[model samples]
Target chain A: MENVVELTNVTKTFKDFSIKNMDLQVKQGFVTGFIGANGAGKSTTIKMIMNLLRPDAGEVKLFGLDYKTHEKAMKERIGFVYDGNVFFDGLNLKDIKRIVAPAYKQWDDTLFYRYVEQFELPLTKAMKTFSKGMQMKASLAIALSHHAELIIMDEPTAGLDPIFRRELLDLLQELMMDGDRTIFFSTHITTDLDRIADYIAFIQSGELVFNQSIHEVAENYALVKGGLELLDRDTEKAFIHIHRAPTGFEALADNMKAVKSIFGDTVVIERASLEDIMYYMKGGVPHV
Target chain B: MKIIISNSSKEPIYEQITSQIKSAILAGELQEGTAIPSMRKLAKDLKISVITTKRAYEELEKAGFIYSIVGKGSFIAEQNLEVIKEKKLKVIEEQLGAVVTNSREIGLSLNELQQLLKIIYEGEG
Candidate 1:
């Protein structure tokens, strides 16, 4: 399968932090999730892909074309939605429709109108008057209507209600049904990823931790909950991150099969969520 | 098709999907040779990760509750009546064991637990 987005040893440096020596790919026709906590370099990698932030080294390719040499062609097939509103406040929905949508060759007014109706945005209302959710919906509407082959969204569901989030996800799912389009969903919200993401890429302090299929992660990583005494077991100590808790310790293991075999029936082998793996990988304090 | 899922259940999403579909087949809710939704369509309808749904379908195929013929979608596998009966009994034993363990943990006597289980089962019937 072709990768919709590809990065090879990509590196970007800043005064404070940098995305270092990263390589990743977003498979075609799959909803690839980019997950990380704050300052985990998720945004940085996205910006580099968009060419909004120049990478100090390495290459980015979209549609199997060089990102630098074919920047215009690459961007034409791409639609981006950043974390916050990225539209002119003075522009009304009609203005966006009349002016912005014309920038793409595949722009379809019919599709735009469908999204407008589905998202419940008023064509006459200025964007400033719209709620954050409405603003996001508008952006998404434009992104979808443009008929972009690859859509990259950054934290698009950060503050939306559950209903809109579902709506947006459903729309994305629908778009990929034809098996020609792809979506790169960047968010810290693991729950949403749990529902829609096919592949997941985890970033930690500007480095890649894991980039694999969601099924692989869910099936392999397990949240092993046990008492403090269980920590003494050599097998349990080999977990990715071992958190000492008030009552007991919770650890995440990539080799869940091995852990279960070693511990037998004593250790509780509970299914781990995407958040659980990310949390433990970051050395988080156990909340429960 | 009847589908079972728990949003906040401790079980992994895929396993829940796999087991529920298996039970539905065993209960005759999903009949043998009935065409099931493709993994993509099922994921879209359930609003779940596609890979997760695919895994569920894969496991179901492995366990013989369903089988997929390439190019065509998945279908419930026809099983011998004896095998179905055994599978249903195993499911019941697992549920009953969970209830009995919980009852003991909460200090309920065996008789009381039996009465509670009977009441719940009767209500379901």
Candidate 2:
């Protein structure tokens, strides 16, 4: 499959945070999730991909073409929605489409109108007047109407109700039915990725930690819960991070199968959601 | 078509999918040669990732319960009566294997283990 987004040895720096030697790939026909906490360079990396922020070094390629050389053509096929509105604030939905949608060759007015009806967004209301969910829906309508092959979103679900969040996921699922489109969904909400992310890219303190398929993530890691008494010097050393309270001890194991063979039924081996895995891995308590 | 998922369960999502589909086939809910939903369709319906659903389908195919044709879709593979019976027996064999290990650890003989198995098998009301 063709890669929709490829960043090899990409480096970026702010005064405080920087992405260092990051390598990430988003393949066609899959939703690749970019997960990290606030200020963890999720947005920064996304900006680099969008060319909003220039990388200090290395390459940023979209659809097998370098962004620097093919910015306009790449932007035409790509759709984006950020945490906040990137469109003009004073313009209404219809006005914004009149100006922005014309930038793409594949812009379909009928599709845009269809989405407006489905989203129940008023055509005349200024963009700034819409609620958070409405703003996201409007942005999505614009994005989808262009017949985009690659959809890049950063925290599009933030500040939305759970029902709306699920609805948005359903929309993304529907979009990928053709088996050709790809989505890069960057968010702090790992549970959302647990549902629809084919690949998970995790970063902490601006450094890429692990980037792998969700299948491998599920297969490789397990949440092991057991009593504190079970922890000997050898067993304690097995976890990536182990947390102990007065009552019991729980930890994240890098190899579920190995941990299962070692601990067997003595410890509770549970399926760790992306949330649990990210929490323990990025939570950063003093480790064994 | 009927699947109940518990997010809190220790079982992985793909395992839950495969086991549920397997049980349904064994119980005759999904008949032989019946067409199942495509991986992408099933993933969308279940509100899960394509990777996870694909994994489940792969597991089912591995177990000889289903088959997929490229560009077509998956269908439940027909199982002979003997094959089904053998599968049941294999399940029992595993349970008995565990029983033997536990009984041996407690120093029980074969006769005592048989008595325990018989009593437990017949004692269910």
lDDT of 2 by residue, B1-125 (tens): 88877777768788999999988988889999999999889899888888888889999999898999988899999877578879789999998899889889999999988898789889983
Worst 10 residues of 1 chain A by lDDT: A279-288
* Candidate 2 lDDT for residue B68: 100
Error of 2 at A161 (Å): 1.5
Give the per-residue lDDT digits (tens) of candidate 2, residues A183-202: 99888888788788999988
For model 1, the docking class works out as medium
**Per-residue error (Å), model 2, residue A276:** 3.2
Model 1 over residues A126-236: C-alpha lDDT tens digits? 999999899999998888887788999999999999988888888888776656778897888888887788999998888888889976787788888888876765765
Best by lDDT: 2
How good is model 1 by TM-score? 0.81
lDDT of each: 0.84, 0.88
Model 1 clash pairs? A195-B48, A195-B49
lDDT of 1 by residue, B50-112 (tens): 777878888888877788997888898897768779877999999889988888899999989
Return the lDDT, model 1, position A230. 69
For model 1, the local distance difference test gives 0.84
Off by over 4 Å in 1: A232-236, A283-288, B8-11, B19-34, B61-125
